[model samples]
Target: MEEHEKDLEDVPDMNKKNSIIESGEAMDQLITIDGEERITSHNEFEPVPLTNNLNADELDPETTAKLRGDAIGDTLYSQSFVLKTLLKFADLNWNQQFEEDLCFLWDMTAEKSVCEYLWELSFPSVACGAVAKYTENRFIEIVIGTLANVLCVGCDKTMTKEEIGVIIQELDSDDHLVLIQVMRFISSVAFSSSETPFIDEEAMNRLCFVLNNSINTELLLKTLETTAKLTVDFKLDKNLVNSSLYNAVLTAYCTLLGSAYLELDTKDGILACRYMLENVTNICGYIDRFENATLKLDITENLDGFLQEAIKIIKYLSQEENLLPVTDDTIFFMSAFQYIFINLNVNYSPEIFIAISKILYIVSEIRNEVERLFESTLELECFLISRSTKQRIFKDLKLLSKHKRKTVLDVVLENGPKFHFAFDLKDLKDEVT
Candidate 1:
């Protein structure tokens, strides 16, 4: 990245077709759909001259994938100017004007054609090169954000598997913004490819690197998301990840629960916790898919410590004050501790939700309750008559997730709208980070 100065500096100015932006007159044809103007906001910046251009060798492994289609008609911009600015971003001297230009690049690259054209111009090396250089946070965020937009391709965007590997493996995990963008890049790589382990083995290790090291909530969640995407519902490929990933994910959950600096009682903390828990559950299932006794044993050993940490999180979340309301479930939380009417089998426990999506998703009313029911969850594990005497409420929602959530409309169709139901996961762990 930092070492690619010569490759970047030596770009000897592209041809006039790409070089000249028509500030004087826009492209003659206007883009239209059904004869109506297709309006879009364009970030305008005064065009600047680029000193150099890429050699033929620098544009090797050119990508022809087109996620964007549609001419840049009447847009008043040039592909060459966009490409040159991005390549030279790291080399430019600091100024408000340049920052404004970078912001414009950020907005311009969102168009698929721009992303496609940039990829053709060997964008991977240019983008990854900047990531390698130690730079300011805002620069890292903009460039990486732009690169992530480019990488979010409908077709193969891998310029070179090795170069892609370099981009992921070399990111700065300590920088929260950098880690977040890299996570998006990782996610794009996972989804864009058709293969299991979506990224190359070497690049996959970078996920563990970020998971094991990053404390940023968003980055952790994003990295976990990418990792979850790469996992198969059945068995996992031995090469997808090594033993260290489990250790890293489990430790991340522990760190998250124990983080004194974060306001864990906040809604965002609760959401982060819920996502991480789900991812951890998925990882465990993935590990269980391993037929190799030794590997299974190793992962099971790792889970012991994580289970302890998880218990602590559960305990922390179990308190009455820690839980928030979906406008307060069943018009009462355990009917304000008076009575909880719930169904259970002989083995009903926290682990039961994993087998069936024991999700108790309900709203206090008619429509939203049914909407959340079909949209997010399964059976009602809690349904009962209410008695408003208590000095309290059970708030222990973990028990409600034992059965598939029923549609409130369906239930109301049978039992009427007055029917009361309460739902919550016994430590919700379904969707991944």
Candidate 2:
């Protein structure tokens, strides 16, 4: 036993540090566990320099072009691979690392040269798949931002018919995030590109679906903006009478107005309301032009029905229960009425004149609901109105004298403050006579 104890003590202590070697140098300068005098040179294990990685002189013209193309292609391919992998891994519980990875890949592919390929190769499928499969807001945002960037880069044919179909399909998603991203992408493409992207019938129906059903304020606003952009060039009098697109526009406007009435305090809700009101003014302007041309026998049948719809929407929105009495909120309503009143004239359709007259009377009579709109003044006057307002009213009234519509004259006299009219009843009579 004493001999064994002595042998254990005599054995070299393995834990003791060896002065011949240190950490980080063992592989570089080979050192055995057993003490040795010789050490292997680091140069023997060094990697060979890549002298032939790229040799421009050894390639033909086709090869050279192919290589240049491959550089972009390879980059897009790698990015798409990474994005797909990350998308597969992404879920509700995805962490910041995955987000960073996706953002990095998106940044790498956001360049114009790479963006088209990236969009064509994988983005559409990946985006739809992510929306359908994942509920991660961060992932959706990254996908949306990336797509917006691609659109900004000018994707002429980047989206195939199938891809557009997929986007339309995703619009039906119950997930608000998915719908938002899809609409945002569509809006970006529509506004950014010089050419209008082809939006099919089914897509239009789906947009109407979103408008009628979506409760998300932001989504509703985006839907309205997209629909307006799509139909800006529409010939309302000729091509859009009772058409699906027309009905869609009407439905979207009504739905948005209703929502705005309900949720006035929220920023998006107010914006949606204001946007629809502005659209109404624009449509009225269009109808006014149509009427002027029709008066010269250039066209027949004034679009009185369209004008009535505009006025109805305005009146619907003007209801006391639907409005917010705050100065900022009422400004849009005041602007709408002022715009309609200034545009009304003697030559305008009786329906239009009646519609404007009714709205004016409502504002004047429903003092309790819209009193705050007129600065809480009891008098229905524009005496304190700005010079521009006075000029516009005078111009519209001059035009009204030409048509001699009595209802318009009476409504103006009853509701309009006496001092606001630039010309009086006698002047209107003299002009008519």
Clashes of each: 14, 2
List candidate 1 stretches off by more than 4 Å.
1-84, 87-96, 129-141, 153-157, 172-174, 196-206, 232-237, 240-243, 260-267, 302-433
lDDT of 1 by residue, 1-433 (tens): 0000000001111111211111111111112224432222122212222222323234334321121122232233466567557656557565666666776665555455556677887777787677567466556656666766666544344656665665565453445555556666655555445454435555556667667766655556566655655553422365564557768776665555566524556544554454454445445455445544564556655555654554454344334344333332322222211111121111222432221222222332333644543222222222221221111112222334333223322332343334343422121222110
TM-score of each: 0.52, 0.43
lDDT of 2 by residue, 143-256 (tens): 654655455453445666565555566665565544655665676555543445457655677777776655555566667666655544442232231234334455555555
Give me candidate 1's TM-score against the actual structure: 0.52
Q: Write down the RMSD of all candidates, one decimal each.
A: 15.3, 24.5
**Residue 253 of candidate 1: its Cα lDDT?**
57
lDDT of 1 at 278: 47
Give the CA lDDT, 0 to 100, for residue 82 in model 1.
Answer: 73
